[model samples]
Target chain A: MAGTNGTIISVNKVRKSYYRDTIEIPVLNNISINVPEGEFLALMGPSGSGKTTLLNLIAGIDRPDEGEVVVGGVNIAALSESELSKWRARHVGFVFQFYNLLPVLTAYENVELPLLLTNLSKKEKHEHVEFALKLVGLSDRMYNKPGQLSGGQEQRVAIARAVVTDPTILVADEPTGDLDKVSAAEIMELLDRLNKEYKKTIVMVTHDPRAAEKAHTVRHLEKGELT
Target chain B: MKIPLKYTFRNLQSRRLTTALTILGITLVVFVFAAVLMMAHGVEKTLVATGSEENILISRKASNGEISSIIDGETVNIILAMNQVARTPAGAPFATKDVATVINLPKTDYVGITNVTVRGVSPDAFALRPMVKIVEGRAFQWGAREIIIGNSIARRILNARVGGTIKIGGDQWTIVGRFDAEGCGFDSEIWGDVLQLTDALGRSNAFSTLTLKLRSPQEFDSFKEAFESDARLQQFVPKTERQFFEEQSETMALFIRVLGIFITVIFSAGAVIGAMITMYGAVANRTVEIGTLRALGFRRRSVLSAYLIESLMIALIGGIVGVVLASFLQFFSISTINFDSFAEIEFSFALSTGIIISSLMFAVVMGFVGGFLPAFRAARLNIVSALRAS
Candidate 1:
């Protein structure tokens, strides 16, 4: 499936459904989207709008019933579970609203996690972790555990972890959903900076209008289709 | 850190109550395992370890222990001239004619007769077993009624210590001292002058056996050849020290070993089951965490390994604890009736490295057996369902 020269992710007429014994319920209705290099796209919808379903499909965490999902020049829809996992590790960085930092690990160790999948030496891993923490402006708090940090600071560490490997794209599912108003604003501002300063591609799913305002473009997901 | 070490610590730390309870269960199981092994060891150490390879007891044909054997004093002198006999400094063969008898002696705690062996010896008998030494008092007079008891007899029985009076059959004898042969089977015996016991019991012409020290273990064949070929005492048979003890322990050892296995198998089964429950609970408690690891790019094998490691640590802790506590059983002496001689013999616990290693290996196996299914369950988790669980 050839696309534009600079396209980073290509989804062609993706249709996904879930089976309940004898019945199949469609979640996405012939969805099609493309995110090129350095794009900042937002997926917006209210509750039950299939926004999360489409995000999961695009992220390669799940496959569409019948369609193509190509990211970073690889079709994840055709990959096996293990192959997809390796592909996700090297190509995709995911940030969840709960800021899923391993509670036992410090901020530094949390950001160092994804790099473990890489074959980097210990010294190289340390450099990558330090650089990622510094990028999120949390270098001073790297030794602090998630419980010791504020909600906003924990989210920043999550962002650092997502981008620690320098992947082609960052995907966030309601990145600011759990934070207070000020902390939510801080997280959105960090994502905007990641887009403009580092030329990072970001795909975000959000219910908050304020969060989507920071994205370069927004798509509304309703009833099984993106409008 | 590796996934196994990482999750093992996390699982133990996260469920403090369950972890402590599981460890306690394992400890109890291990304790029983160790205690039974100690009892079996005690029985063996009392008998087998006491015999010296170079010594032989010339008992009668078909006679087992000394209580069933008797040879005249004249026969003892005839066996001393054999070429394979070890010589004293004066070039006389290192041999002594003696009387060995088992008596009903009272223990400090048990009211029944604890069999205390009393050996009536000549002066040369001391040299025959150089390992024995008078630790508390002097040896008995050559013809006096004074007696000396072994260390274990003196410490474990009543009225048997140094300067105490003990009655054997109908005769009263004074315990002049306590002696030791390095806490071997000899430590539960009494020694007196042979002529006194012979004269008092009216068996003056008879002795239990002629004790001889051979030059080495290899000289047993020559020793047997010289003794058995003598036309004068054609029935006299020579036995190596180890062979003699082996004959004594043969029946009893098998009985004890079977008993040990029976007891251990019961406790080991309970322990293995207890470990299984704890490991399953561990998997149930950490299902979400396992799912999260799967979502984070860890392979199923790594997750399984992590759970197995955690179980092994717990089982190993319990096993080591059992062994340490079992070592203390060395101090406890048990009185078992020797069916061959019908005398209650005393035994002390003996620990061997084989027992410890076997116990540790058994614990590890229990960990592996108990932890498998749960680990498989953790590894097979669907990452989405698990992350969405709680």
Candidate 2:
């Protein structure tokens, strides 16, 4: 399943629109982009450039008004809601800008949540959670809650959670947007390790020049058109 | 659906004030609901526990209880002569003429006048009623203006203690003693000589009713025919004492049940709304957490069940508290008007396992009904939008 030439994401001219009190506000206008498996890609854009909209479409979180989004070679819009959920659990891992870790759970439990979807034994799941935490360089802080961890530590926990299921693609939205320079450098370093060492296909959306510098290929998105 | 319990609990803890207020509302509703059920059951217990399953009560046709029936002293003797009647070792029939009356007695604890029953009976009355026993002072003297008050009379009503004298019709009747009848309805009365009570109340020719213990249940028809065949009487009813007491409870039981359901419905509605408000706030506060769960690949059904489980936990807490508080009331006494008898009746809060179980079931149902919509909202949240909430 680890391949450098296979396309993990394929979008066929997808379009998205929003409505503000019956006024159709177009967001992603006739866009198509794809990242192969194990390829690290960055989406760089200004505000209101439809970069997040395209990310949402690729992650199976939103449906396109026209055309189709196929992730991991499965057309998501064609799948039922429950099927899409199962696909998301198995095919995609997600990391967000703010490191949206549930504040109640310890970092270990946060990492263990996605693993619960797999049919792994409890002992095996524990092993995977431990490895994911260790991979993110926060194995010692596994017992700490998100609130107890610093911004960088919280993002690392989020990363651990995203990778626990060993998914084909990692969809990250400004993964270092809230971190300081040192923490941002640490996070980019962790994503770099995930891409190079684990052969992860990371698709990150960011306005940060440094974050984009870490990606193997950086593309500019302006007014829903990719360049 | 696998729901992590820690998420729900932490969300509840973060909104401590709302959760506490919601639980308090549920407690109040459950308390009122249980109290009404207890009172209703207490009414049924008041009647059902006092009557014997095998005894026969002879009265004029169509009459209800001893209060509305009248029989002569000569008829009392003749009915005592029937061979179908059970007897003691002294060769006397197991029957007695019970003269029952009610007089207004001022309540010691409240401002209203409560009617206390006064029963005049013969010495064999004690022998006929095996459940009757003197828990306190001795029996009343025969053919004298001396009365023994029932235990309820002594404790709740004024001027009922032994050795106390009270005037009736300008003559002071001495309270020579007090007694109990093993918690039967007789315990609510004052007992004295039939002749003296008839003479004092100036209804000298009438004894209110007679109770006869049959040799067996087979003699009931013959006994009824014998009374109805008497040419001089026409209006009294002859029934098994058990049936008569059961008839007396129907109206009171219906009244209590209706009242209980009414209060519970009104209060439970408000509690359900309160639970809705609390659950809505819980869902709102945990948007990011929910988003995290969704992004971690949890199904929508899991989030729905998690919120519902949290609401049920609150309701269960309130229900247990209400039941515990109601159990404490087993030691207190309550008196209310019995609709069948049209007289004041004393009762205790009757506790049964059914009442407690039903109360808990009711509260848990409220939690589900109230929490379902809000939990659905959480489940249907947009993952990207939810994660972006500041």
**lDDT leader:** 2
Give the worst 10-residue stretch by lDDT in candidate 1 chain A.
A1-10
Q: Provide the global lDDT of candidate 2 against the true structure.
A: 0.82
Q: What is the DockQ of candidate 1?
A: 0.31
lDDT of 1 by residue, B1-390 (tens): 245355367557777776676666667766676676666666666666666677887888768877778888678777776777788898887887878788777678767657767788878888778878998878887778899988778767887778888886578999898888876667777888888987766789799877888777688887777777788777666776556766776567667767876877777777667778888877776666676566556777878888878888888887888788888888877767766655666787778888788777867776777778777888788776666565
Tens-digit lDDT track of model 1 for A1-227: 22478888888898887778979888788999888788899999878778888777777777888889888888889999888777777877888888877776789988888888889999999999999999889999999988999999999999999999988788998999999999999999999999999998999999899999999989998878889
Docking tier of model 1: it is acceptable
Worst 10 residues of 2 chain B by lDDT: B230-239
Clashes of 1: 1
True contacts kept of 2: 0.55
Candidate 2: misplaced stretches above 4 Å?
A1-5, B58-61, B70-84, B167-171, B182-184, B216-243
User: Measured against the native two-chain assembly using Cα atoms, what DockQ does each of the candidate structures obtain, in the order listed?
Assistant: 0.31, 0.61
Per-residue lDDT tens digits of candidate 2, residues B72-164? 877777777766788877887877677887777777787778877788886667766777777767777798898888788887787678898
